[model samples]
Every structure is written in structure tokens, then in C-alpha cells.
Target chain A: MSKHSIIISNISKSYGNIKAVDDISLNVKKGELFGLIGSDGAGKTTLLRILTTLLLSDSGNAQIENFDVKNNYKNIRQIVGYMPGRFSLYEDLSVEENLNFFASIFNTTVAQNYDLIKDVYSYIEPFKKRRAGQLSGGMKQKLALSCALIHKPKVLFLDEPTTGVDAVSRKEFWGMLKNLQKKDITIMVSTPYMDEAGLCDRISLMQNGKFMETDTPENIINKFQKQIYSIKSKNKQKLIKDLRKYKQTYSANIFGQAIHYIDKRNNIKIDELKNHLKSENHIDIEIKAVKPNIEDCFIELMKKEQSAVTNQLKN
Target chain B: MIPIIFIMPVVQLVILVYAANLEMKEINIIVINNDYGSLSRQLTDKFSSSPFFNVSFGNSHKEANSLMKKDKADIIMTIPHNFEKKLIKEKSADIQLLFNAVNGTKAAVAAGYCKNIIFNFNKDIIVNSPKLILEPINYKRINIINQFWYNPQLDYKIYMSTGILVILITIVSLFLSSMNLVREKEIGTIEQINVTPIKKFHFIAGKLIPFLIIALFELAFGLIIAKLLFNLPMSGSLLLLFVVAAIYLIAMLGLGLFISTVTETQQQAMFIAFFFYLVFIMMSGIFTPAESMPEWAQKINYINPVAWFMRVIRMILLKGSGFAQIKNEIFILTGYSITVLSLAVWRYRKTG
Candidate 1:
């Protein structure tokens, strides 16, 4: 068996003139929890569909657990379980019936793989008699996870599984994933929420059909390469506008109630920034150096990629 | 859904059988009397006494023509002046008959009825007139007695019911099967199924078998109604009918699967299916004879599955034909089923 559960090399897919998945490649080791973090239209779903053998890439190739996605798609289909972004279960069928149906299609019974999905399945077992369409959004997510895990697949592909789920349900869903990884099943999940990036062992920050960075969340943040300051004032909207107008501002964006600002130079003087904001009729100005998170690192990488493209165009 | 499947066929069968009548009756005729002679009055009374004609009197030929122009009359018969004198002196008299030819079939039938009435009146005159009896050297008369085969009464409902039953089966199986796969596409469940390890043949069979059984059940239900309400005959073996129906349904269901594969939505599938249904039903000879169509249309009916079954079912049920009688149609249907099903399977794709 190969050490890597998934090996994608220079896979490219295009829809007419628009490239949905540009030439992209990555490797996910067995038993590792990998995340593809990006906003909508970043080609995350397209890449996952290629790896699951549901779609063909226009160029390059991909493999799931050493089975070629092109020639050995049958073998790949037998080993991988996919949950699409939409609720695709038989809505008229009950929860237990839906799970049983998926399990039977995979040539296994629910009792055969009961232990694999016990943690997730147990959460919705009490409401198993209710129709799938009648279940709450969070309950539906749990049932979907149970169905995906019912066959004890070697690799599970979840495409935005928690997108419309509630916050508490999203957290619980992630917790369920952590448990599944302990059983040696390689998990590849995609989400638009940056806060969920920390849960994965490794993640690829994607934009415009290409990956900007692929590394551990902590390492990506460590490579921010500049000091980021969080500044708060009485007028947050005015503070953001004033910070963008400053000559030394590298980038100014609103993060919650404060503005995360970066400077053009290596070191920035906090009193100088406070005095600049005060001059603009700001009050209760507070500026402090704060450690960068995944969102901060993502913004910085995206900005760098944008500048690189413009420079290439000029050349 | 189950109730609708069972109820719709019965409703369509009853309503269509009762409403679609091909037999023509009650032709309206206008008679213009130019002579007040006894012979002319006798001819006018002969037309009014028959069950087929609704008779009305007119003063002049112009009045009858105007009535026909207003669509108030179907045929106009004008008796000429000196009608009795010409018949007595010259041994012949002219009676002019004009017909409204807007509906060609109705006009032709009405003209035939008029000819029969006139022929009978001539026979009465020859037998009753002492002068004609003495003068005639001989009269050789031949009459034809019609014995309608299979349907002695020539009830239009019996013929229409069988054709409607074939159509009912076609609609249920073809429309349902065509919409089945496209529905999954609409609901986004096809993507989930495509990722599974299920084989294409298995998937296609799973979709076909259930509808095939339901269609067969519908056929049985429609047959019961036909027998009870229309007194339709079932002279052929029920088993043979079902076997042939199974083969015919495979062809129809295959066509539907082909439509489903080509279309992306239920609405699109419905439109395409309806187009085929219209062409198939019209060309199937259900409402009209396939043999009487233009030569090119007759050639097109060779590829029409419904046309094949329509001819076969009538032969078996009405004519009590055996396997040897309908073997040619069965062979064609078997080949059609294989070709259409293979095409559908070939067109189905698991991955883009």
C-alpha cells in the first residue's frame, strides 16, 4: 500500500474559458486530517470531485489510495465515501432507512460497520424514524456524516458538510471528525470558515483555482513576515477609513470590533498611530501588537499573490 | 402516487372510449318539391320515413341552396317539373342531388345513404306499375348481405377501448421512466449515487423493473374495465398478451431511459417525451388505419413500437390470433427492445 492516501499531480479542470481547477497538486498521507480552506468559487469542490472519481480533470491525474481516478475509478469508488455540499439523501425516507440504503449500496450492512459510525449515528438515533427532509439542519448534518461513515471507507470526502449548520453543531461535527481520524481513516474536508482551519493537521489556503499556501496552520501564521496590530477606537467605521488613509498602512481590514492593520515599514510606533487616529477625531484609541491568526495569514498571502500577478502582467 | 397510477388509467379509458365515436348517424337533408304530383310526394315521404335522415321541406331550389350555405342542411334533393309525365312517356326522370362536402367522410356516407333510398324507391316503382311489369322482358336483381366479422355490431367503443389501453400503458411507463432519472438529477441525488460502487447495468435495471411491473398491473386493470364496460373480447391467451406486453414495455422504457440520459431536468424530459408521444400515438394507427396513411408515413410506422403493439393487440384480442399469426410483430418488438435498451445503456455516463 502507498504511504499517501491521496496523490494529485498537476490536475487541471476547465469549464469553457474559465478554469475551475487550475494546475494543482498535493499529497495527503494516510490517517491524516487534511483541510482545503477557501471561500466560495475557489475550486475546492471541483478538486474533491476529481479525487473522488466523480469528475475528470482536463489535464494531469489523481489517485485515491493508489487507485487511479481515471482507469481504476471502480476501485476508488469502492473505497471512498463522499458527502456533497447539498442535502442529497432521499428526503422521503427516514434517517435509518437512508443510512441502511447507503450501507447496502456499498455491499455492507449497517450492523457490520456500526462501531465506525456509533459516535455520530447515536446523536440522531432517537429521531431515526423521522423523515430526512423533516430533520433540523444540525440533525441532518449528523445523519449525513453517519451515512458517509457507515461503510468504513478508507478515505472520506466531505464538501462543505457544515456550511449551513449551526455553530454548536459545526463544533460537534468537527469533534466527530477528530474521532474518525483516530481510527486511521484519511479525511479531506473543505470549509469556507477560516476559524475551522486550526482543527486540521494540515490545510491548503486556496484562491482562484490555485493554492496560495499549504502547511500546518501554526506554520502558515508564523510565516506572516510582518507585525500585525489590532487597533480599537470609539468609531470603528471611521477608524477603518482613517487607518486606510494613513501613509504607513500596508493593509487595513475590519476584524470583529477592531481593525487589523499592518505597516509599510518593519517596525511601527504605536503612539504615532494613536496620534494619527486622534487627529481624525478618534477617542479611546488603543493600539497593541497581536499575534496573527489564519485569517490574517490568508489575507497577507492573498495580497502577495495579487501583487505578483500584476508585476507579471507589467513584465 | 400509487392511487394516481391506478386511477388515471381507468379514468382515461372510460372517458376516451365514451367520447371517441367514429360511426356516423343522423344526416340532415332538405327536399325541394317543384311538382305537386303523387309520385313526387311519395319520394319525399320515403326520405322522411328512414331513421338516418332528418327531413325538412323547401319551396324552391334557391331556398334549399341557401339553407345548405347556412350550414343548416347536409344534402339537397330537387324534384323536377313533369317528373311523372317524363317517367311515363320517356321511361326516365331526373332528380338532382347536391351534397355539402365540407367534412368529406360525412358527406360520402350521407351520399351512400341517399343512393340506397333512391334505389329502393325505383324497385318499388317497377314492382307496383302494371305497365312496367308487362313491358319488362326480365329483371335480374342481386342483393348483398353484410356479415361483419369479429364485431358483429361494429361497435366503435370496442375498437377504441383497445387502442386507448395501449396508449394508457405507454404514457404510464414512458413518462414515468423518463422522469425517474432526471428527478434524481434535479434533486442532486445522482451525484451521490454516481460515487457509489453500483454498476451501470444494475442501476438501469433497478429503475426499469419496478415500472415494468407497475405498467403490467395497469394493463391488467385496464383490461378488466374494458371487458366489463365495453364488453371487449379476450379471445387470445392472457399469458401471451402479458409476455408480448413485457417486450413492448421494455422498448418503451428503454426509450424513456434514453430521454432521461439526454435531458438534465424533469421539465425537459417531459417536453421531449410529449413530442414522442404525440408522434407515436398519431402514427400508431390507434385513431386511423396505418395502411391508409401516405406511403412515407406507413414506412415510418415500421420503427414505431406503439404501432407494432397496436396491430398485434387487436389481432390477438379481436381476431383471436395465435403465436403463428403475430410472430412477425413479436420478432420486431424483441429486436426493437434490444436495440433501444443497448442505446440507452451506451449513452448513460457515470462521469463527465
Candidate 2:
């Protein structure tokens, strides 16, 4: 039977009085590609830290590959690889030197684990002589991945691995992650880019140290409980405010090229909404029912949480 | 078998034990003897026989003074005229003693030696020529008393080693702390490390081991240099010195780790480490005695790990003091090492 690569139960961590990860719980199956999707500071890094055995929770506990995170961290560290949110590498060491150093730290040599990092390392091989501090964003990211995977860890944790990289580089990185997944390396990646969520086997949408939902990306999109419509007008600024005043409007937020609004008047037709907006001093009105994706799911989840808090306060 | 971890430390202890004690082996002295008589020759013999000083005869007082200012000489003695005639006429005489004040303690000792010779000379002259003092011309004179404490002469090498060791360790600790974290950052391997099956302590220890080796070597080199140049005595047990140094490194590395946790940029980490290094070095009592500090400043020494380490190293090296003599400093260092390390790990967990 395959071992559960990572398991966390009600793990909690705080800095002073602020709860960075509040009673969060989840599991990453032996070979699943798990993702924690959220905006920045959504407790993604905190949760990853605990699971990786680099952090001990204030309460609760976790185990990686059947080893207790607190007691068996050494064993866990040997088997897992982590790429933190920020680029942390020896600025003075050359690219090849860094790889050798980390590989040696794990009691392995680069030649032994050469196959694991061969793909990534090949891309940065031309720049191996360059000091790590001098590498470009994309090249540095590749070299960092090469070092992290040099030990051939059973599981990999990448925290916002694509942040600040160019679009082409982002696409290339995701492609590399896909190939690594084929190696049966259990991967947990955190990213602010919601579009990447669909590429994962499962995702947990997080906000303010809480997980709004945890499920497959397709399921999250399918289970979005609101009918979302995109509306655009000549005066977008005023159009958003006017749409909020409507008694039937449940939620309104700006998304891409339109003001996405969910309405309580589910029976109303699209043409009627357009004509109503035109009558209300909104020009060049266009309205359409758009298919909700992961982004739509996130907005709906946040609105629900906020309304719940407001109602509790009133009570 | 002695553990490899401790081999370097043992070597360091032996080197530093001899390195950190100074007993002023050679004092530079010049003779300005205007008394060209048998008495002048006798006085020069006394100085030449004493291994404590190297005498340069027939030099002018002003020339000798200039050598002292240039750091070439440490003492100058001027004998006034009427040297042999003073004894014949039974008149009082005085010899002028001058010393370099760069180290007030060493200067004071040289002056005390001059006083003792004069005192013994007066006694000898009176005993041999009893009738010469019948008029009771026990002519008024002066006496000066002085004492030197544990390293009483303010040995320069001893003074310098203690201070230099603190600075060296600070640099070592800072380097180690940043190295452990920044390695992951640079390799793009932090993400992989964060996913590792190994525990955090294992990861932290694995990173620290190599730097610890390098630092222990640095400590050894400093000690060896001190011993070869200054034949200072080795007073403390090797076991005790290593134990104290181990504890002190913990505190230093903890501080370095704490700095790494708060800084995103390695450049920023270096600046923060430098600031703390400067603060600890300035307060460690390597250059000045803690007894001379104000009460508030003295109280602060309780918290400064560098000061405690300096105290422990000097006490062990100079006084050859055992753990019993330095128990308070040992306890303080032990507490600091534990507290700082735990706090650093906690902060790292919070920020990681």
C-alpha cells in the first residue's frame, strides 16, 4: 500500500497574537498534485511550513510519510523537498556549487540524483558559472528547482514558485511541474494565480488564515452556488455603484473586463437587465451570463463568509 | 575516541590558554646617567642583571622620552649629578623615573620597581656609613606602594586576545546563521526543502555543522598566534574552555539565525548582523574591565553574551580558574545559549 506522503490535523501557528494558520487541516495523498490557492498572506506559506516539518504548530500536529512532524522531522526532511516563497540560496556560491552543496547535505551527490533534476538543470547549465545573485528571475528559478529536486525527494513543496516570473516563464514552470508529477512525487504548490488552480488535482481556496473551500478545481467551479453575469457600461465606476443599490443584487465585484454581479432576481432575463441599466444613466450597456470559473467561486465564497459574519454581529 | 567535533576545540583551548595571559616579559629602559662615577656603574649592573628590563645606557632623557612616544621604549631613568659625591658629603639625592602611559598599569609597575631600588639603596648606604648620619640627616624621602592583580601588568596580548576572540566568534556566528537559510533561498531548493521528509532540527543541524568546523579552526589559529609571540601561561583546563566556547557559539549562531529570519535580502541580513556584532563587541569588556563600568552598564553585561564569553575565556586563560571560579559566567552563558537558540527556532518557524 502506498504511504500517505503528508497528513496535517488541525494544525495551528501564530506570530505573537496574530494567528497565521488557524486550525487548518488537510492531507496530500502519496502522489497527488495538491495546491493551496489564495491571495497573498492567506496562510498558504504557514500551512506548508507545518507540513514540511520546518515549523511546529502552537497546537495540533502533523505527520509526513507516517513520521511525526515534531518528532521525526529529520526523517521527513530527508524525503521531502521544499522551495520556499522567497528565493533563498547562497548568493556567493556558483549555481553548480549550490546544487552540490544541497545534494551533499542530504548525503547524496549530484551524480546520484542527476536524473531527477536533469530537465531543469539543463536549462541553466549555460549559466552554471554565474553567481546565483547575478542570475535573471527565470534562470534563478530554474536553478533553485534543480537544487531542491537534486535529492530526489518523495514529495515537493513549492511556495508561490511562479510569482514575479514572466508569463512565458510561468507557462514553462507549470510544464516542468507537470513532468515532475509523472514521477509520482507528491507535490503541494501555493500560488496567487487562480488560473493555475485548474491544473491541480485538488485546491484549497484560502483567505485570512482560513480555507474557504477544499476540493477539485472543476468541482469548485461546478459547485459555485450563484449565477454569475458580466455587465459592462460606458461609466463602469458609476455602473458598479448603481448595480449595488438594486435590491435584487446579492454581490458585485470587478472581474477582468466587466463588473460581475450575482442577483437574487434569478428569474430576470439578460435583455431586461441591459435595458434597465440603459434607463439608469448607464450607456453602451452589454450584459451576458458568463460561466463561473475558480475566480467566480472565490468571490462567492468570500461574500458568503463576510455576510455570515455581518449577520452574526447583528444577532 | 575524542569526537571530531571536539578535536578542533581542544587545540583551540591549548593555544588560547597560553595566548590569553600576559606578564610583561620585556620592558624597554634607557639610562641617562650623568653621575659618571662608580655608583653609576653599579646602578647599570643592577638593571642589566634583571631579566625584567633591557637597558640602553648613556642615552639623553629627551631622546629616551622620544623612543617611548614612538612605542620603542617603555621606561626611562634619569640620574642627577653628584652621584658619588652625594655619598661623600652625605646629601640627599633623587632619581627621576618616566614611563609610557598607553597602559597605565604597566607604567605604574615600572615606577614601583624604581622606588624599591631607591629605598634599598638608602638603607644600604645608612647601614654601611652609620657615623655619616650621626647628625640624624635621615633626610626626608618618599615611598610608593603598588600591587598588580590577576594579569596585573595589563599584558597587551592577553588584553587583545580576549577582545579579538569575541569579534571573531561574532563574525563566525553571523556567517553561519545566514549561510543556513540563504543556501536554500539561492538554490531555489527552499520549496523542495520545505516539502522534505526530514525534521527541522535535522535540517538546521545539518546546515550548522560545516560552519561550526570552520569557526573552531579560526579560534585555533588565533590562539596559536598568541602563544608563539607571547609566552603567556596556560591556566585553564582544555575541557572547560571548550565547554564554554561551545555554549558561547550557540548564543552567537542563535542571534545570527534570528537576524536571518527577519530579513528578506541577504544584504539586509549582513547589515543587521554587523549592527549586533558591533554592539556586543563594544560591551564585552575586552578593552575595558567590567568593574570600571557604571552600575547600569554592569547590569547590562548580564545579558550581553559576548561580555560573558570574554569573562569566561579570560578567567580560564589567565587565572587558570576552574568551573567553580567562573560558575556564574558559565551559568549565564548556558542560559543565553539555550534561550537564544529556542527563540531563533521559534521565530524561524513563525516566519518560514
Candidate 3:
């Protein structure tokens, strides 16, 4: 019924002197499973909180389903379901009691919305008698989502929902979100997992409290302009330093078994890199061109921002 | 197997009942006697003979009352001028006795003891005074029957136990509700709820209602103990007491709710609660009589919901007072209950 389920415009939030969320704007299309991909302190949460109407923006505004986050917050609340980054249900209450209590608050019976949370509910329904405090982390995550979904909101804003969850639970939660999107419920989920970016219809690559770029996961990865290659040697640290000194090298950062280096090396080949590595006191040198993934794009964004900051400081 | 959680309340009850006594056996009283006549001497001798009475005043009852205000004397006894001539002439005489009634029960006991001595001394003189000189005199004897409405024997333990138990239940339950939510903020579960379509009022009411029911169970437990173990009479309507308790509990729970919303840590909320708890319990008339407190202290009682509740519980449970009898107290407590609850609801976190 709406073109954009959520619209954020020039939103800014400052915690003391630090701008947690700088002036940023984004639109979530109808039924789009959007992802806020950022590391810690990238202001992913501040953005989610602003869109969810939990924290007010210092300037600018956001809307969920034609409801202004500031002016029509009550209506926005009814339309949107927010699963905060934390497990916030009543831990002292039994699982069933917590569900019942939340259902009561919305003036709806649990029976009425059983279908909405049925998927998540089934995993935890057997443990309904268990005190929420005693539940394992995955179970708590599921229960928190079930409670949030009890009202069947139109827009779902999850602030890093899968941050601490196990791999299996994280996979299952995203699977559930995929199904929920079929119902045309716009889902906005935030996560630090670079691998999770592929699961979203669109992903925003962010670093240092700003969005580096926003596009389909494939397009963003496609536009990684530089060729990336991994070169590992006995002295990998020394290899990384030698690679950075190359004038044609665009970026170089150590990644697990090797250094993920991107370069504008026009005529240079892998053999040339290996020969140069050996000449620079490196041993057991191996270089292989590797596909650039989301992490590579994230590092590139961070480097671009860092160089810009350094350049401005010099000026 | 023994239940460990039940032990908490039971142990608290024991510690509270023993420490809640307001009675002071070592009361300091100052006497300023200017009249050295036979009457004054007899009056002094009579007071000095009683264990409850003591003479410590330097000047007069006025000075003693001032000293009492400044925590000097607990009580003061004054002797008027020419007290022997008035007694010999067979005329009724009076001596002023000033009491520091801030600590009601103690003050009431000391004042009554002093009055009894004066009355007895008067009767002795009226009977022994010259019969020939007086034209056939007959003296009247007065009888006083003291009755306690809810707690008839004036037992401090039962009175304090019932009132304090109610307070403990409401406070514990309310604190649990508040802390439950605050813990989420600490642990990060609240973010899930914040993004949900759940209404703000629903969240607050949902959190509050469970604790309210728990507090009700405790209230019933307290009333049962008051009726059976303590043998406190339930003369008025049980339904009335039940309704009144419910109303007063709303105020108590509201206080806890407000505390939870204003504070971040469970410890901070508890500290704020305990601070108010100290003031309310002391001024609630459980250990002291509201009637005997100073004008300013009495003014505070008007706003204190517990003070009003003690009167209702005693009237309904002890005196069996009807609506017409306790209508004023019921209205006041109900108002306090509603105001506190509304304030709690208003302050509850709606956006965050």
C-alpha cells in the first residue's frame, strides 16, 4: 500500500560532543528486507533507534507508514515492531507469562496473533513454563522476536538482532525474515556480520558514523574497482609493509592467511609480486587473486574515509 | 525439601517486628515546681514515687515543652501558686502537665499516668478533709475504660506487624516490577520491545498487573495472620478492609513504579524507595498516635496514604466502623492512591 515503508531524512544524533549519527538519509521500499551493515560505533543502532522512534533525532525526521516518527510516534509504534539490540523481556516471568503480558498490553490476545509468531513460538512454546532468565541465548533471541512479532507490525526494525546469537539461530532468524517478507512486511535488520549483507535486498556499507554506499549487495561488490589479491609469506607482516610501498597498490590489509591487497598494477603479474616479495627478504611467498567480498568493500570504505579525514586535517 | 525464597519474607518479618517498637522506658522529664506547700509537696511525692514519671525540668512546663521541641524533656509537670489553700477550701484545682506527643504512644502513657496521680490525690484529700467544717459533702468517683479500635489492648507488636507487613509486601512487589524492566535496559532486551508495535500503556500495565496480583496475595496473608495469630478483631466489614487495602496498595505500587521510571539502576530505585519508606512508616501512626503528633507533623499525615490506611484498617477490623464513620479516611486514601498511580503511569518510559 506504500512505496516506502520507512523514510529517514537527514537524521542526526549527537551523544555529547560526538555525533553518533551524522546527517544521513535512506528509504526502505515496501516489503524490502533492508540491512544496516556496520561495525561497532558506526551508528547503526542510533539510526535504528531514530527510525523506530525510541530516540529522537537532533535534527531532521523519519516516517514509518506515513506516520512521522516524532509527531505521530504513537501511530508509528502501532505500525512498526522494533526488536532492540538487547534481550529485554521480563526474565523473571515464565515464557508464557511474558507472552501473555505483552499480548495484554497491545489489547490483543495471544490466541488472536498465534499465526503471526507461530514459527518462533513453536521453538519456545514447549518451554513456556520456563523462567525466561533460565533460557539459553538462542531461545531468548527467539522469544524476544516472538514477543516483538506478537502484534504483527507492518515494519520490523531489528537493531543488530543476530550479533551474539549462534550461527544456526542466526541462519534460522534470517530464514524466518525471508518468509515474513513474502507477506509484504518491510524488514530492516542491522548486523555486523559481513556475510549477512547478501541476505538483504539492499545493504548500506557504513563506517565511522556515516554510510559509505547503499546498493544491492551484488552491485556494491561489483563496483569494487580495484583488483584484490592475497599474498602470504613466512614474514607476512614484512610482506604487508613491502606491498604498501608499491606506488600502484590501492590498499593492503592482512586477512587471515594472507594480505588482501588491491592494486592498479597494469602490467604486473602475480610472479612479479612474488619476485618482489623474495627480493624484500620475504620467504615462502605466494600470491593469488581473490574475489572481493563484503569485508573488502567495508575496509575500502574505512580507508577512503580515514584518508579523507587525514587530508582535511592537513589542509 | 525447604523452599529458600519463602524464608526471605519470614525472616524480614521477624527482624522488623522486634525493631519497630517506639516505646521509651527511659523518658527524661523536667519538673519546675515553685509552690512548696503541702499540696505541691504531696504532688511531687506522688509523681516521684511512680516508675514511669521522672523530674528533670530546670524552670517550668513551658520551658520543658520548649526543651522537648529541642529534644530536651519527654514530659513536664507544673505546680501552680497556692495549691494547698485551694485544696483545704475544698475547691477543685488543676495542675498543668505538658507532654511531647511526637512519639505518641509513649507520650500518651506518660500523660495518663500523671493525670491518674492528680485525680487520686484529689480524691484522697476530698475524703480526708474536715467533715465538720464542710456542710455535708459527697465526692464523685470517675471510671475510665480505655479501648483500642483494631488493636484493643494497644499491643505494639500486632499493630506494627500488620501495618509493616502490608508495606513490605507492596514495596517488594513494586520493586520487582520496576527492576524487571530496568534489568532489560542493563542487559539490552528493551530494544526488542521498543521496536515492537506494543503500546506504551500496554507495556506499563502488563508489567504492573502481575506484581499487583502478587501484592494482593501478600495482603491476604497479612490479614489472615492479623486475624488468627495476633487475634486482631475484624469488627467492620471484611469487604471494606479488602477494598481499602487494594486502594492503598495502588499508591504504594505507584510509588515504586515512579521510582523505577526516574532511576536507572535497581540499587538507585531501592535507595529512593527506602528513603521514603522510612518517612512513611514512622509517620504512619502504626507506632504513634496521629492525634497526639504536633500540628506540622499532623499536616504531613494528611498527605501520607499509610496514615489514612491505618485508620481505615483499625476502624473496619477493630472498631467495626461503617461508611458513615470512615467516609473521610476512605476518600482521602482513594485520592492518594489514584494520584500516585496516575503519576506512575505518566512517568513510565513511553519512547525509550
Candidate 4:
């Protein structure tokens, strides 16, 4: 077997004029938990679908466990388990029936792979006789994960599995993924939540069908290259407007309770920003430099990419 | 679903069989006695005595004409003045029979009844009075005897109920099978199934077999109803009927799967299935004979599975036909099943 569980080379797919996966290439090593972090319509689902052999690429080739996605799809299908963005299980079937059905389709019994899904299945096991449609959102996610893992697949693809799920369940779901990784199953999960990026071993920040960066979450945050200051005042709405009007402001965005402001000049004084806001009829001003997170890196990279496109258009 | 498969067929069979009758009955007649003579009275008595006609007396042609205008009378018979004297003196007389022709079939049947009654009255007069004959001439008369085959009584229920049974089976199998795969697609479960290692042939067969069994059961139930309720004949072997029905169902189920593959939603599948069903049933010779249809329509019916089954079922049940008599239809259905099922399997795709 190849060292890589999944390999792609310049895979590109387009719908009419819009490119869904634009000249993308990546490699997921054996037993690695890789995350594709991007907002909705960022082509994460499209790329995952192509890798799962459910869609054909307009140009390029991909492989799963050294089997070509086009010519050897049958072999790829045997080793990979895919959970689509929507809850796609039979709603009328009971929880136990859904798990057994997927197991049988793959020519395996649920008892054979019970160890792999024990942690996740235990959450919903008490309601195994209940119909799938009657389960809550979080319970449905657990059942879906259990069914996907029921066949002991070598690789699993989960597309936005945490979307629309409660926060506590989302955390527990990632914990379950960590347990599956320990069993040597390569996992590729996509999510729109930026905080989830820290949960994966290596994360790829994607936007507009392109990957901005692919590295550890800490490394991406450390490479921000510009200092971001979290500024607050009594009037947040007015403070944001004044900050944008400031000549030195490179970008000013409202992040939760404060504004994450970046100056054009790297070497800047905090008093200069404070004075500008102070002059805008502000009171009780607080300004402090804060460490950037994955969301900060993502916004910075997206801004750079947009300016680059505008420059090309000028040329 | 169980009720739809079992109870619906029985309800439809009973309702449609009794509703679609064509036999004529109780025709009303109004008699205008202008002569007030014994012979005219005797003619009126003859019309009243016939089982097919309900006779009433009217004084004048105007009165009977008004009754016909009001739709109260089906036929108005105007007897001429001096009808007995004219017949005795000149051996001829004129009587006008006016019929309400709004319902053309009813009008024609009523006219035929009036002619038979008048003919019988003339024969009675000729037999009773030999002096009225100017000369006795010898002539040879050839009597034609009528015998209706297959349906000796020409029972309309037997013909209609069998055809309706075929329609019932078609609806159960075709609509259900066509909606099955599309329902999966609409609910997004098909994507989950497509990722499995299941082959296309197995998937298609799995969808087809259950509906096929249900449709076959419906056919048997309908046949039993035909035997018990309508007293429909079962001249041919029941086993042969089922074998042909199985082949025919395979063809119908294949067509349904094909429709499912081409459509993305259950509603679309239903519309397409209904369109083909309407065309097939209209040309299936159920209500009208396929032989009498336009030449182009008959040619189109070659591909209509319902038409083939309608003809074969009637032939077997009514004519008591054997395998040799229906071998041609069986072969055609087999070929049709292979072609359509292959098309369905070929059209189904595991990847997009």
C-alpha cells in the first residue's frame, strides 16, 4: 500500500463558468486526521465528493488507497465511507436497522466492527429502537457517525457533519473522531466553524475554490505577520466607523465584543490609535494587543487574495 | 400501502364493472290513436304487451309531440284515420313512428323494437284474415338463426371487468415501482446507497421484485373477484395466466425504473408515468376494440404492454385459449421485458 491514503494532482471541476475545485492538489498521509476549514460554498463538499468517487472531475486524477477514482472506483468504494452534508439515512428505519443496513451493504456484520464505533454508538444505543427521524439533531449526528464507521473502512469522509449541531455535541463528536484516528483510520472532515480548525492535526484554509494555507493551526496563526489589536469603547458602532475612517487602518472588523484593528505600518504606536479614537468623541477607551486566532489568519489571507485579483484586473 | 395494494383493486373492479354497462332496457312509447278503430286499439295493445316497450295512450299528434319535446316519451306512434278500412279496402295503410334521437343509440334501439312489434302485428292479421289476400302466391323464405359465441348472453360485465383488472395491475406495479427509486433520490438516501459496494444490477432488481410480487397478487385477487362477482370464465390454465402476467410485470417495472432514472423527483416520475399510462390505456382496446382504432393507433399499441395483456387475458378467460394460442404475445412480452430492463439498468448510474 502507498504511504498516502488519499492523493490528488491538480484536480479541477467547474459548473459552467464557475470553478468549484480550482487546480487543487493535496495528500492525506495514512492515519492522519486532516481538516478542510472553509465557509459555505467554498468547494469543500465538492472536493470531498470527488475523492469519495461520487463525482467526476472535469480535469485531473485522484486516488484512494492507490486505486484510481475513475478506473478503479469499485475498489475505492469498498475502502471509503462517506457521510454527505445532509442527514441521508433512511428516516423510517430504526437506529439499529440503519447501522446493520450499512454494514450488510459492505458485506460485514455490525458485531465485527463494534469496537470501532462503541464510543459514538453508546450515546444513541438506548434509543436503538426509535426511528431515525424522531431523534434529535445531536443524536442523529451520532447515529450517522456510527453507521459510517460500522464497516471498519480504511478512510472516512464527513462533510459538514457538525453543521447545525449543538455546541456540546460538536465537541463530543470531535472527541469521537480523535478516537477513530487512534484506530488508524484516515479521516477527512470539513467544517465552516473556524474554532474547529484547532481540533485537527493539520488544517487547510480554503476560499473561492482555492486553498490559502495548509499547516498546523498554531503555525498559521503565528504566520499572521501583522499585529492585531482588540479595541473597545462605550459606543461600539460609532467606534467601528471611526476606526475605518482612520488613515492608518489597514482593516477594521467587528469581532464579537471588540474591533480587531490592523494598521498599515508594522511599526506603530498604540497611543496614536488611542488618540484617533479619543478624538472621535469616545470615552472609557481600552486598547490592547491580542494574539490572533485561525479566524484572523483566514480574514487576512482572504483580503490579500482579493487585492491580488484587483491588481491583475488593473494590469 | 397494503390497503392500496389489496382493497383498492376490489373497490375499483366492483364500481367500474357495474357502471360501464351498454345493454338497452325499458324504452317508453306514446300511442296516438287517430282512427279509434279496433285495429288501431289492437296495435296499441301489442306495443303495451312487449317487455321492451312501456306504452301510453295519447289523443292527438300534438299532445304526443309535446310529450316528446318534454323528454317524457321516447317514441310517438301516430296511427292514421280509417286504418282498418284502408287495410281491408286497399290492403295498405300508413302509420308514422317518430323517435327522440337525442340519444342516438337509444333512438335506434327503440326504432328496432317498434318495427318488430309492428311486423308481428301484421303477421297476426294476415294469419287471422285469409280473405284480405288478392292472390295466394308460393314463395320460399329463408330464416336466419342468430347465435352469439364466447359470451352467449353478451354480458357486458365479463368484458369490462377483465380489462379493468389489467388496468388495476398496471397502476399498482408501474406507479409504485416508478416512485420507489425517485423517493430515494428526493430524500437524499440514494447518495448514501451509491457509495456502497452494491452493484447496479442488484440494486435495480431489489427495487423491482417486491412491487412485482405485489402486482401479481393484485392480479390474482382481481381474477378471483371476476370469477365470484362477475362469473368470468377461466377457460385457460391459471398457471399460464400468472406466467404471462409475471413477464408483463417485468416489462412494466422496467419501464417504471427507467422513468425513475430519468427524473429527479417523485412528482416528475409520477407525471411521466401517468402520461405513458394514459396513452397506453386509451389504446389498449379496453373500452374500444383495437381492431377498430385508426391504423396508426394500432401500430402504436405494439409497444403498449397493457394492450397485450388486455388481449391475452380476455382471450384466455373468454375463448378458453391454450399456450399455442397465446405464444406470440408471450414471446413479444419477453422481448419487451429484456429490452426495457436492460435500458433501465444501463440508464442507472452510480456516479455523477
lDDT per model vs. reference: 0.92, 0.78, 0.78, 0.91
| Per-candidate chain B TM | 0.94, 0.65, 0.66, 0.86
* Best model number under TM-score: 1
Candidate 2 structure quality by residue, lDDT tens digits, A201-302: 999999988899999998988897678889988888898998998777888888877999888875767776776787798878878888898988987888
What's the true lDDT of residue A310 in model 4?
A: 100
Residue B252 deviation, candidate 2, in Å?
9.3
| lDDT leader | 1
The clash count of every prediction, one per candidate, is 0, 37, 19, 0
Per-residue lDDT tens digits for candidate 2, residues B1-352, read 2354345444444465456554555788888999887666767777777778888874576777778778988878888888668766756666777788788878887777766666676666665654355444464566566776767775676666656755666677676676557545555455555554445577667656666666666676656665666555568986788778877887788778777766767787888787777777788786668779899998887888988888888888888999899998888888897897787777665224
| Stretch of 10 with least lDDT, candidate 4 chain B | B134-143
Instruction: Sort the predicted structures by TM-score, highest score first.
Output: 1, 4, 3, 2
Worst window of 10 by summed lDDT in candidate 3 chain B: B1-10
TM-score of chain A of 3: 0.94
> Which regions of candidate 4 deviate over 4 angstroms?
B26-140
The residue-by-residue lDDT of candidate 4 on B219-268, one tens digit each, is 99998888899899888888999999999999999999999999999999
TM-score to true structure, per model: 0.96, 0.62, 0.77, 0.92
Worst 10 residues of 3 chain A by lDDT: A265-274
Interface RMSD of 3: 2.7
DockQ of 4: 0.84
Instruction: State the TM-score of candidate 1 restricted to chain B.
Output: 0.94
TM-score of chain A of each: 0.99, 0.95, 0.94, 0.98
Off by over 4 Å in 3: A92-131, A241-250, A269-272, B1-162, B169-181, B187-190, B194-202
